[model samples]
Target: MEVNVIFSAILIFIIVYLLFSLSGILFPIDRTWYASLKKPSWTPSGKTIGIIWAILYALIALSLAIVEYKIGLKNTSITFMLLWVINYLANQAFSFFEFKAKRLDLAFLDTAVVAITTLLLIFATLQYSVLAAILLIPYLIWSTIATLLAWSIYRLNK
Candidate 1:
């Protein structure tokens, strides 16, 4: 509830938003190509995906801020912090692999990595704050689902 936590959350949110946005902007999705993909019937609409990402990004920022506050940003364990950083980078690359590069296999691989990192991030967060760890559960769930979806899409497309 400290001001530092609030400020850190806001700052991290902006940083995440900007960095993620850059991926989308730099390698914009080819709608025509994406539309051609043989997606599963359960695939969510683009709007739904966007909305879910918005919520997940917000939760990610807050969770990270809470963990950082508990552990002290300066004193954080490299391994713990790397979990989130790795997850973010992997996530940002998904668009590149799936949309720009049009590589479903790589996309599926990246999603699996993201899901794995989400688990590590949650476990690492637990050492700092239970609330922080719990906050990341949704992300873990979503990433797992995404990995499955990615695998399905890759298989279907091939």
Candidate 2:
């Protein structure tokens, strides 16, 4: 890709991902069922997850910036970044849809989509840059645990 285009894509990815998070800034508190759920002992507190996610998202954005500046935006790299961002956004959307819209089924599906897309991002990342792939490891791991959490919530509240 052209250098300018690559940089543009990177900027767009970061901005879009930030917007996605902002769109659901109140998700944790607004989720009524989330507050009521019997969380697992392994579940991290909302504050902890928030801190982790904030750091992770910032890392992801910076990592992509590194790629854009250093590597000039390979197609594989751009694909990995976009897929990762999309899945992350989708994951947040589930919380809003489930608690606010009261659509457990749709929320379940959205969570499943996030999990699947996360896997895709991991795969795409692994194909080229180890740094990119490594950056997504926590995201993949979290999504796996989140899938289980979502399923548990659906079963418990259904």
lDDT of 2 by residue, 1-158 (tens): 57686667579568745865774565655646567776666777878877877776766665555555555455545676688668767967876877677676677778788878877876776556667667777777776777787677677677
Candidate 2 wrong stretches, greater than 4 Å: 1-17, 26-28, 31-33, 74-89
Query: What TM-score does prediction 1 earn?
Result: 0.91
True-structure RMSD, every candidate: 2.0, 3.9
lDDT of 1: 0.84
Flag clash pairs in model 2: none
Where model 1 places Cα greater than 4 Å from the true spot, the runs are 1-6
* Candidate 1 lDDT for residue 75: 73
Clash number for every model?
0, 0
TM-scores for all candidates?
0.91, 0.73
TM-score winner among the candidates? 1
| lDDT of candidate 1 over 1-158, digit per residue (tens) | 68877677667667766765677777787889989999999999988988888888778877876765665666778898788689989999999999888999999999999999999988888878899889889989999999999999999989
